[model samples]
Target chain A: MLKDFFRTFSSMIELEFRRLKHDRTEIYSRAVQPILWLAVYGPIMGSIRAIPTGNIPYTDFITPGVLIQSTTFISIFYGLTIVWERESGILKKLLVTPAPRYATVIGRAMASGIRAIFQTFIIILVALIIGVKFILNPFYFVLALVIIFFSSGGFAAISILVASFMKTRERFMGIGQALTMPLFFASNALYPVTMMPKALQYFATINPMSYVVDAVRSLIISGDLTNLWLDIVAIAIFNIIMFTLASVNFKKIIE
Target chain B: MEKAVDVRDVVKIFNKNFRALDGVSLEIESGSIFALLGPNGAGKTTLMRILTTQIGPSSGHAYVFGLDTVKEGSQVRKLISYVPQEMSVWTDISGYENLLIYSKIYGIPKEERNNIINGVLESMGLHDVSNRLVKTYSGGMIRRLEIACALLVRPKILFLDEPTIGLDPSARKVVWEKLKMFKKDYGTTIFFNTHYMDEAEIYSDLIAIINRGKIVTIGTSEELKHSVGGEILHFILSENGLHEDVLRELEGIEGIKDVVVSNSDVTFVVNDAEMILPHIMTFFNKKNIFVRRVSITKPTLDDVFLKYAGTRIDVSGRLSEVTHVRRMIRRG
Candidate 1:
């Protein structure tokens, strides 16, 4: 049974890989966004002020946080791939096949995380050239990967939840942009959470990006642990809750 | 005999309150080439979609190759390959790549996919067009590719919607030959939908004519042609006054049901054109009504369609559509 599940999962992943060959949008947006945030935004901040990020170079402190942000943003549109398929009659094609929907979901999530990993590497390479306080510690590096998988997948589930109800391409795009941009803006996108106003801080605590950004912020920005477990726990809870919701919605629409 | 497709009281209503299909029922015998003929707003596509398991019925049930479309949806889908009417080819990809993607999705073994793809492509004479992006392909090549995609699965039943919509005369002949080959080689039951009467009449073993979301008529072309019974007498009138008087007398004849007198001539509906046509012509000649043109033709399926739908069934007949077909593959 486990082997069967793995085969289905891998096939689903392979399906996405096939789609990626034709999907050119990822080459531009996923790879370029974090590099600009790091090489452009990070350097401007480090040169301008002492910054709130301890004494370390601002680029080093901000690199992982930006990487996580980009992953979440990119992954949240995993459902858009479905929307395109549904619009193109490819969804009909997929539904007719014997492959399970859960495998489709998990496989899509796998694809999203892998793409994010590649994007994160690009940003890291750009940061290294720009003299950011880069971390070579394998433990923290692995931790960064875990954070991306959890947060990116959770965001993708949310995307799937919205995409399930959409009937048109415009509606899909509207929902995708609506969820992604707000989460980015509400989190500690450009500043430390400690610097936020009281109401903003209260709102930031519940936002998912707050947890994801905080986890990456702790590992790479502060070079120390502070409430990392809370982010991990919240992300795990979000993953389960949203994944269940997405799976249910996905089944409903297809049926 | 076992049936390849059995549908009873299938219905579908869109969320926007459009009643696409209203309780459609049909049975297609195994190995028969069945043609579904309907006007633009008719429910043919909806019925096809439900049978293919791409959309579920609002009510009632359907089965393909004995597998229930709803309960055994995966199995039903496994048995059917739908070639939708639209230009569904991948514009940015080669025809070969498109076939490869669909083959993998259908879970065809690698060797078989290659063999089928090569065979189907070569049969369609599309092996030369397989390398270029589909955007550069002509209308006929694109349609051939659509058929190629559907055939990759070696399905027991093939559903083709407007499969010959854009083909030229010669390409259409090539397509018909391939369809005949497909059935002869695979014993595949073809459930085809077309507005082109020539395509349907010349190719199908059985024909069902639908109008206004209902199947008003179903039979072979010969059966439909003889359904209203008897023969048809036609007269083309010029802007001259000689032929009208005799046609007026024939309008009052006992067995005639309809008379259309336009300009200088009259058209008569009769129980037997052989019985009434010569009498009318003789009367017109004796009375000096000047018969310009007269012909005896049997009632056609086109006449039956016009009789029921109040319109002609031309593949290129322009539709100022009250509702567009669902913007899906082959307009859904």
Candidate 2:
């Protein structure tokens, strides 16, 4: 059974990888969008003195947030393909196959997680070019990538869970857009949670994206291990819940 | 002989308001090609999904090879493969890649996977285009590729829902030939849904006709055709049309089971065509209703359907004549 799970999971990931590889426009856009934000939006936002970053520059402060933003955008949109698959009847074909439901969803999450890492890499490279410095620890960098994968996976699960109910492209786009902005803004991705109003601050604190950004920031800028484990534990629990829900819902929607 | 599929009193309802499958039941003999004939929305696809283990029936049971489809879906899947109504292949990927993915999913050992993919592709006559993206292939090639993928696992039973729905006649023939070869070579039980009655009549060993989510009839071509136990008579009028008295006069003739009059033709179902032809000709002679042409044929599956369902299976508009009088049959 374990062999079956891993075989199905790897094949699904491979399918997604091949699909993205052939899609030049998607790869180009995925690579270009984050760099644009890093080079364009980061400079403009960094100049504001009102922004709170204890010692790190605002550009560096927003770097982790931008990485999380890129991950959120990519992960949320990953589900649009599921809607397309449903329309094209691929989902029906796959559902009839022997592949496990959770494996299929996990493979998809891993694929988009891998894509999120590439997009994050582009943002980080642009950050270096734009004069943002990191602690340059290999361990922290690997830890940051792990955080990105799970956080992106958590968001991808939410996207897939909602997507399973969407039978049409227009409905998927509407829900995706509705969820994307709120998830990004409610978290500390673009701003400090301390600077937000009380209600928004409350949402930011519980938001999984907040933990991901905090974890990344701690590893890269401050080189602080404090709160690192907390963020990891929180994101891990969030992923498990979201993934279990998504997998269960995936089978239900088809029925 | 083992039964490849057994569906007993299966009922499927959607949203508590719609009953998609209403007490549908059927049994398909192992290693025989079975075709399901139904009009649109007749629950053919629903029943196929149930047997394929993609969905559960609202009530009752469905089994494939003695295993309950709902309870032993994984075991059932190992013994069967499905080709859905739609084109399920990834258009952007090469045909080889598509087969490779399925081979892995089917858990073919790593060493034999490539050989099985190659063998299946070659058998489907898709080897030449194996490296080409599916989008570049013609509709027929894509359909063949779907079959090739299904065959990689060497499933004992292959379920195809409208396997050749939108293809050209030649393409449809190619798909059928491949399916026939697959059946012959491996003795695979092939169950399929088709809009083409002629295809169903010719290719299937046993055919089951479903109407309004119930099995109207199940038999071989000859048995289904002979179900009505009569012959059909079609009379083409000489433009002057039928006399008002003709139907009344024909009803008086012995062995005439029923009569249906249309704009330019009159069709009759009778116990024996030879016995009734002379009486019908004499009646037309007396009424001055010109019979331009007369053709007598053994009962068709269409007649079997009209006998049971009270309407012709109207895939082709040839059943337009039946439509005009179908309500009369229903009312009676």
Candidate 3:
């Protein structure tokens, strides 16, 4: 049984790699959009006011948030692949193939996670070029990457669950884009939670993306993630809940 | 021999009002080509979908390899391959990659997958286009590739729904040839659904005629043609018209089973055309009506559909006529 699981996982990775190699334009757009956020949106918040978590340059402040932000935005594109699969009838083809049916969704989510990491690394490299001090610990960076991976994966799962319920690509795009902005804005991606009213602060505090961004921000900027153990446990619980909800909802919607 | 697939009085209603399949039932032998023939909306695709565990029957049950379709879908799904009517391949992947993904899913060992993919592609005559993205490939190529995917898993029972619906004649012939070869090689039981009567007549060991959510008849093509028992006489009369009573009398004359009137053209299914044609022509002559034209032919599967399903190919506009297909073939 364990052997079967690994076989499915490896093939799924191969499928995702093929997809990445298959679409060069997707690669360009993925790189270019986060850079656009880096070039423009990352600085506008800088000149306005001292960022909530202290006098940290707004770039460094929103840097982790922007990575999570763009990653979350990119999460919905996973549904575009699914929508195309549905239109091309590939979903039906995958449906009847005997083993590892859920692997299709898992493969896609993990592929998009890798995509998120690539996009984040690109943005971080840009920041590094501008002389953001380098942190020397590989373990914390790896932990931070895991936090983003699970966060983006939870978001991708929800994206797929939504895609299963939608019939057409156009409809999914419109609805996916519409939902993305509100969810991103509600979090601390653009501004810290203390900048918000009491009610919105509660929501931002509970936003899993907020936990993810704050955790990563501690690693890159402060070098000590505030209450590092609590951050780890909280985000783990969030990932469990969201992934579970997405999988349960995934079966119901597709059926 | 045990039944490979058995659908028992199955009924599928989509939204309480839209009835897709109504009380349909049949038994498929372990290793034979069973063709379901009908026009669009005739419930052929719906029945296939239900049999393949894609949907549930509203009022009955289906069994595959002695496992209930709804109750034990995974066991059944493990053994059969379903190639749906739509083109279901990734537009961006090569035909070879498509097979690779499915073979992996079927848990073929890494060492064996390449050989299996290559062998299937070579047999389907797709080796040359194996690396081409499916979206850029011609319709026929994509279809053959889908057939290759179904075969990749080496399914014991294969269900192909309108497998060659949009292919050119030459391409369609190639697919049918491959299917015949596959059946011979593996003794795979094929449930082939199609709207093309000629394909059904040529390839199916047994044919089931479905219409308006019901199976109207089922038999070997020869048996169906034999059961209809006669020739068809077609007459086109324009300037003169016969009284309804007179036409009725001619229709009742012993040799005929049914009379079909379309505009001034009257078609009749009669047992003995040598006797009926002369009588029909003489009746028109006695009425001083000019005979525009007349033709007669032996029983065809089309005639069997007309006789048993209460439909005439030309007059029943509810379904596309054979003439439409003939025109398409001519146009192509």
Please identify model 2 stretches exceeding 4 Å from their true place: B232-296, B316-332
Candidate 1's TM-score reads: 0.79
What do the candidate models score in CA lDDT, each in turn? 0.74, 0.83, 0.77
- In the range A129-185, model 2's lDDT, one tens digit per residue, is 889999888988998888897788888888889888886678989999998888788
Q: Score the docking of each candidate (DockQ).
A: 0.21, 0.40, 0.36
lDDT of 1 by residue, B1-332 (tens): 88898889877888858778777888989999999998666878788878878678888899887888988886677678887654555555678888876676566776787888898898777998898776677767877888888888778889887777656678888888988998999999999887778888999999999886778889988778877665778876544643455556767767677887666656667777777777776766677566668788788788989877788864554332211322233322
Residue B267's lDDT within candidate 2 is: 91
TM-score of the second chain of model 3 compared to its true counterpart? 0.76
Model 3, runs deviating above 4 Å: A1-5, A249-255, B231-296, B310-332
Best by DockQ: 2
Candidate 2: residue B330 lDDT (0-100): 20
Docking class of 1: incorrect
Which runs of model 1 end up more than 4 angstroms from their true locations?
A: A1-12, A19-26, A47-51, A77-81, A105-110, A137-153, A198-206, A214-237, A251-255, B15-18, B85-92, B165-173, B233-296, B313-332
lDDT of 3 by residue, B1-332 (tens): 88988999999997679888889999989999999988778899889878887767889999988889888877888889988776676666678887887788778887998999999998899999898776677767878888998998788899998887767789899999998998899999999888778899999999999988999999999788868876788888966456788778887778888888777788888877778788888888887777788888777888888887787533245323433542332222
Candidate 3 chain A lowest-lDDT run of ten: A246-255
The model with the greatest lDDT is: 2
What value does DockQ give for candidate 1? 0.21
Please provide TM-scores, in order, for all candidate models, with all chains considered together.
Answer: 0.79, 0.86, 0.83
The fraction of reference interface contacts (C-alpha pairs within 8 A across chains A and B) present in each candidate is 0.17, 0.74, 0.62
